[model samples]
Target: MIRFIITRLLNGVVLLFAVATIAFFLLYWGAGDIARQILGASASQETVDLKAEQLGLNEPVFSRYGEWLSNAIHGDLGASWFTNQPVTEAITSRMGVTLSIVIGTVILTAIVATILGVSAARYGGWRDRTLQVVSILGLAIPGFLIAIFLVRIFAIELGWLNATGYIDFTDSFTGWLKSVTLPIIALSIGAMAAVAQQVRGAVKDAMRQDWVRTLRSRGISENRVVYKHVLRNASGPALAILALQFVGLLGGAVIVEKVFAIPGIGQISVTATTQGDLPIVMGIVVFTAALVVVINLSIDLLLGFVNPKVRLS
Candidate 1:
């Protein structure tokens, strides 16, 4: 188990490096004259040139990439070209808001998805078919569209909650939850549908196994047979999907955040891209990549506990 964990951790590190390299080059390729964007058209040519040099934009791509990587490793994500503040500080300040939304979405999605999944799997008739159709519809709709619809219905029309901005959970937990609730619901809708389908399928498959038949033949109570013998055996795949979806929720929350006007890492990334804020963009990318890598590693460890067979392999 220790060896397996170490191997997974190493693989996660490699994946994060690949993610960073790809994000860095992609941003570098798409962006144009960061200094010029920051200074605007009215800035003097000499001033722009000096700013560019200071930012290492005048250097070769390889050299700049190396410097960026080194600084990132040292916890210095460099200074934002637009805000002129340390990238780490800027991202850290906003990290709490993003984390709150992501965590809330994951929890809500998991609970709702599991209930619906178990219900559909156990019932497996008209109810199952109805849920399947609803899941398909959910999969078809984009998260941003759902966010917009939710904002319109709950925020604008009914005025049940605030539509924009965020409150710190520490300062006012109730207000923070109220503000983020709609966005969380929007982000979790698709995830719930997807997760429920996966869980239902897994449960159905587990129910067909010889052990389940054996339990049924022994005259075990149907409830015990389903919950203990079936659902427990089927949980491996559902748990794995849950872990992955939770990780994905971070990036998925971006569109939802924008729709609801909540400030988060996704919002910060969008702003940085529009303003050509290289440091901020890079910081967000690296931070998100690291988060995904860590989540993946944690999932791997969890799988070992969830199914000892996986660890044996």
Candidate 2:
């Protein structure tokens, strides 16, 4: 298990390094005259030259990469060129909002999907048909549209939640819940539908196994046989599917944040990219990569716990 963990960590570190390297090169080479962009087209060549020189844009790309990478290793992701704010500070400040929505979505999706899926599989008539129709519609609709509908109905019509903006959980836990609830629901609908189908299929397969009959023959309660034995056996696949949904939720949250006016990592990322704030953008890239790595490792650990055979790989 230790060896498996070490391997995953190393892979994650390597992936981060690769992502950072690629982003740095692409941003520099592809983005034309970033210093000029910051100063605007009206700025004189001499001023641009001076600004570039100040930013070490005068240096070779490889040389700049070396220095940046070295500083990054030492936890010095340079300050934003425009605002002089540290990149890490900028990302960390907004990270919580994004995380709150994403985490809530994950939890909601998993629990509800599990119940719907198990019921659909075990009872199979209207429940199965309903699951199929809902999953299809959920997948067919875009998340942002769903978010818009939620805001319109719940926030505006029902007056249940604020239409826009975020509240810190520290200020009021209830306020925070209200702020994130619609966004979480919007992001989770599709994920829950997808995961529910996966769980349904897996559970159905598990039920077909001969051991299910053996368990019932041994006088085990049907609920225990299904919940304890069948669900546990089927869970490996369902967990894997759930883990994959994190990536989708992270991405979907970005669009949802914009619609809901929530301050989050996605907002900063879009801002930095448009403004050519390389330091903050690069910081986001590395930080986001690291987050993805951590989530993947956690899922791997969970998978190993659920199905010990995973660790053997």
Candidate 3:
């Protein structure tokens, strides 16, 4: 298990390095002149040149990449060229909103998927078919489309919630919950579909195991046996799917954040990319990659703990 964990960590490091390298060069070559963008097209040639020199844009590409990589390794992501705020500080300030939505979406997905999946497995018939149909529709619809539809129904037509806004949890937990509810539901739909399908398969398979038969033969209560024993083992695959869904959520948040007008890393990423704010864009990318790695690692550790067979492998 220790060796497996070490190998995964090393692989994550390598993946992060590759992601950073590719993103750095892509931003550098494709983003045009960062200094010029910051200074505007009307800025004099001399001024642009001075700004470029100050930002080390005049240096060799490799040398600049090395410096940036080193700084990132040391937790100094540098300042945004446009905002003049440290990239870390900017991301940190907006992280609360992003995290709130992500966490809420995950929790909602888990609860909905587990209930729907287990119920479908336990009661096969119209219930199972109906759940399958809903899952397909959920998967078929794009998250942004869901966001728009939800905003229309819940906020525009129903007027139950704000169309687009965010509130800090510190100010009012109730306000924060109300503000984030739509976005969370929007983000959760696709994930819930994917997770429910996987859980249904896992639960059905688990129920067929010999141990499950043994428990049933002993006259154990179906609910206790299913929930306490079957679901615990069945959860391995579900947890793995959840991790992948989380990565998707991060990417999906880019569109969802814009639709909901939430100030988050995703919104910042779009703005920084458009304006060629290299530091901020790079910071968001690296941060996202690192998060992906950490989540996957945690899932691996969890799998190993829950299923001893995985530790042997």
Full ranking by lDDT: 2, 3, 1
TM-score of each: 0.93, 0.96, 0.94
Write out the backbone clash pairs for model 2: none
lDDT of 2 by residue, 1-313 (tens): 7888899899999999999999999987666688998888999999999999999998889999999999999999999988899988988999998999999999999999999999999999999999999999999999999999999999999999988999999999989989999999999999999999999999999999999999999999999998988988888889888888997787787799999999998788778888999999899889888998999899878877776555665
C-alpha positional error of residue 132 in candidate 3 after TM-score superposition, expressed in Å: 1.4
What's the C-alpha lDDT at position 52 in model 2?
A: 92
> Residue 73 in candidate 1 has what lDDT?
81
Report the lDDT tens digits of candidate 3 across residue range 14-76. 999999999999887666677888999899999999999998898888898999988988999
- Model 2 per-residue lDDT at 42: 96
Better of 2 and 3 by lDDT: 2
Which lDDT tens digits does candidate 1 get at residues 96-191?
888988888888987888788988988888879988999998889999888888888888999888788788888898888789999889888888
Residue 221 CA error for candidate 2 (Å)?
Answer: 1.4
- Highest TM-score: give the candidate number: 2
Candidate 3 residue-wise lDDT at 61: 84
By descending TM-score, how would the candidates be arranged? 2, 3, 1
CA-lDDT, candidates in order: 0.83, 0.91, 0.90
RMSD of 3: 1.8
Which segments of model 1 are wrong by more than 4 Å?
none
RMSD of 2: 1.5
Clashes per model (N, Cα, C within 3 A): 0, 0, 0
